[model samples]
Target chain A: MRNLIDVTDLSVAEIDELIATAEDMIAEPDKYAQVCRGKQLATLFFEPSTRTRLSFESAMLSLGGSVLGFSEANSSSTAKGETVGDTVHTVSCYVDIVAMRHPKEGAPYAAAQYSEVPIINAGDGGHNHPTQTLTDLLTIHREKGRLDNLTVGFCGDLKFGRTVHSLVNALSRQKGINFVFISPEELKMPAYIKENTLDKNGLSYEETASLEEAMPKLDILYMTRVQKERFFNEADYIRLKDTYVLDPEKLETAKKDLCILHPLPRVNEISIAVDSDPRACYWKQVKNGKFIRMALIMKLLELQL
Target chain B: MKIDSIQDGVVLDHIKAGKSMDIYKYLHLDKLDCSVAIIKNVRSGRLGKKDIIKIDSPMEVDLDVLGYIDPDITVNIIRNGVRVEKKHLALPEKLVNVIHCKNPRCITTAESQLPAIFLLSDAQKRSYRCAYCEAEKTRRV
Candidate 1:
């Protein structure tokens, strides 16, 4: 009966259950491979995102379910000027569940408002991507063996990183967790998040520009890309972005067990040299993305559809 | 300091002076059958200026129109010449089947028959983003 539009939509217990279900799926993959057999996942992505779009498909396929819908706005009735509500209502008839990504904020919520089937917000502009938060959660649970008591560092772009905002909103709820916000001034976490979520929760976090200084004490380093488009001035982007790259040299200062996580298609926020360090969990994060989505698809559709 | 009371009516008070006409146009209050007392340039110790509109019959107040006119205005429901309830009008939870998305190219904005639906994201912020275009709208009347 509920839609997964934001990470806040899933309670702490539900998140734990989702991570636990993902763990079980990982251990016994074949058992859950066909749980969603014959069901279809309609992915209405108004924006082009190969990684996210494919992850949903991979998740559904791994669940023995079929995938339907479009990747781009041009390919869909959106090009013909069909309304999002109409599109979702129409697609809901053909699919048991829906995942929609749009360039506009709240578009998925609008779709969810009318969808007869369960709706998953793949990504809605800069608003949220709850599934990515699920991936981060599963990764944290797998790597750290628990979601609590970890000092997680979010480096690089935080200002406009929906994944960063979603992850922070998700993790700030857990007990004994602390945060190190590593970003340049221009890309610092938005005030709304700091004021609304972190400060309101009374979570312990410090904002800093230096990653190396914060690296040693962290249990998880969640790196997000420093987007060029986010900057109004090219000089600002140039000056601030290069300050937080995580190379092998920087990894030596990090904890031996530090889990490096990124919602991927990363653009050099973490150097390629750090990829083989066994601590790099971004690719593992991607795989976890698929399984977590599989868990979500099963969880959402099983109850309602 | 005397005020007339009406049975089964509404009393809109503390509106900004000179805004009565705007509120009237916004709410389309002219179309209704009830006797309406629209007091303009009224004295107010609190606001330094004010206006009031009294209706002699109960009418459904258009909150969207109210939201557009001035978010600060208050409404009072009167029954049997006694004040029953004083309600502060607010934007509805989800404005569906009303308004039109302004973005001409947006799918929902283009669909003439479909109501322009907008979900109120931040209430205190007094901002309504178009559900289709992701455009932010500020109420000014």
Candidate 2:
């Protein structure tokens, strides 16, 4: 049941293979158009997501595969209170693969227990989202030309960001990867991630609250929104909210090739002024998501052009 | 409960239902030369169902290990065809560094200096969670 419940489910070698396929898909789209003819993809999103649902539909459509799914729990049998395992078991009968998103953590993993087809976790509530992790990896590989020997800085709400945790888990498997965690004291990275993923792997990393101080030393800066709710008090939020925002002023100390990345729907975390900068790669990440998903669909279906 | 037909043996009473094997293995009863009888699913007044392990000969048992695994267990020392002494056990409420938390979000995961402490969350379900993060302890089926 080769399900991607977590980013760690795929090895570094497997990720490289997926990346190679994604590159091939990017270079030549027509050659792989009819690879999944007559295949049906079920995008079982228990939570509503415009970009992610569209990404999966677009990827399946690109591969000549049709898509079927409900956009929210209201439209599905789950509205009547069906269990995730039962819904997935029934969906497996009609679809070749399953991509699920839920509001509860570990919902996809629970679905995988009964699903007969391959299960892909689109996103879960503050939990593993391997596809987004794959998108970040594909973008990083394409932008930097290597996954190793680079310093990556993750800024903002590290405690609740599933994307940061997934990326850190994946990157820790690579060689010579140094991590710089930049965030306010309240939003600092969780100890479990630090102990289990980084230190347990014998990886080197340092923590800082100043994104500007870590800017010049970084090869990649992955930015995440720090919601005001993550802070304990208004005083602390006012004191620290602006420190992580990437702006033209912050770029003065950064390297010319410093690739700035952000998981989308930015709310002033990266100033509007920095979008025009040559280093902004968050939009590129959105595009790479489709290609990487295309590669993942083919890899999971075991289809070839 | 009394092993009326036997002489000079030890009796373990009021073990949680189906936990006799844990006690059996903990005491290394498999390699013992004496006859060992493990009674399972025995009816009890306090507990609806329980298990009992009886050693056919007098032997020294580690009460600390037994108490930690199940506090409800009581050991009856039998010698010369008579019950000599009964030892009751009391386990501390918090277990420290005895087991690790399975939760990925637990504080003990990163703070290597902090001890992994777990508290019994559900006695009937036999479930425990980390004291810091309060993640439910998962058991191997």
Candidate 3:
């Protein structure tokens, strides 16, 4: 009955458990290879998300579970005027679990209502992508060795980045967390997030425009792209697209062990030169993304450890 | 200016002036075959000017519509030509179909069959968000 529509749906202990399970999966890949044998996963992607869809399929396949379902609305019954509930209800009758991604916000949540099996929200428009947050959390925990008492700086488009919102929400529950948000005034983190999470808990945080100005003090640097899809005006998108480009020069003032992370498909926001730095862990985030999803699939299905 | 009192119906009092029509429309008073009177801009000692709605039938009203439109309003249930219960309204925790989600990216926009559910996200500010999309909507009327 449990469905992950938002990162907040998982508690601190549950998140720790998921991270632990993910770490164990990384350690012993052979142990979980056949855990999901004979089980099926339905990837009900109503949008085209190549990396995310592939990652879910790869994760299920790694668990020896077969994958089925569509990649876009045009290829499915949705194109034939079928509702999401009808499609998911029909798909759930055949599959053991469901992984859904849709362009409209809350489609996955709506699917969970009609689905007989457990539902995992892959990504829902710009609203929520909890699995991405899990990947980020796993990356941070593996790199930093802890999740609390460290300064986390979020850069770039904090406004529309669901990853930033989910991560901030997850991190806010931890003890002694300091947040430094770096973005232009137009792209600052939403006030509701600050008011409801950080300020409500009395957590310390500061806002600045320059990433370099906040770099030296950060323990974890999370960068995000200024998504063109979120902006309605082409002029606004063009003006803010090149706002912050993180290159090697920007990392000169950063700490050596700073865990630099980005949710990828980068278009020059992260310079190619920064890839060689030991602190840059965005690649590892991709690797961890699969394992954590495997753990999440296992957890939601209540499969054996 | 006097209106006949109902025998076994409901009286909505203390509605903020000029908000009676919205409440009437939301409550679907126009569709009712029974007597429904919307008295507007009535002089009040406390509110200065307020609106009242009198329903002649013993039909139930949507409390959420009344609450969201004007929570300051009071409700009186009349039974057998006598006052039965006087109820004061407060902002409801959830609203279903009282208002629609304006966000174009919301799932409710495409699926017209889906119930339009909005949750009271911020009570003090009277802010509601679509249950599906979490799109913030402030009080419109």
How far out, in Å, is residue B84 in model 1? 7.0
Per-candidate iRMS values, in order, are 4.8, 11.0, 0.9
Error of 3 at A215 (Å): 1.0
- Candidate 3 has a DockQ of 0.75
Model 2 chain B poorest 10 in a row by lDDT: B105-114
| lDDT string, candidate 3, A198-274, tens digits | 88789999999989789999999999999888888889989999899999999999998999999887888999999
The per-candidate count of clashes, in order, stands at: 0, 0, 0
Give each model's whole-structure lDDT.
Answer: 0.81, 0.82, 0.90
DockQ, in order, for the candidates? 0.25, 0.06, 0.75
Scored by lDDT, model 2 comes in at: 0.82
Tens-place lDDT per residue, model 2, A149-226, is 999999998877778989999999999999999987877888767865787678999999888789999999999976
> How would you encode candidate 1's per-residue C-alpha lDDT over A210-298 as one tens digit per residue?
88889899999998887665556889878876767789998888888999999977777788988888999999998888888888988
How much is the lDDT of residue A88 in candidate 2? 91
C-alpha RMSD over true interface residues, model 1: 4.8
- Kindly report which residue stretches of model 1 are placed more than 4 angstroms away from their true locations once superposed: A228-243, A303-305, B1-9, B16-22, B30-37, B41-49, B56-58, B63-141
Judged by TM-score relative to the true structure, which candidate is superior, 2 or 3? Answer: 3
What ranges in model 3 sit over 4 Å off?
B1-4, B43-45
Docking class of 2: incorrect
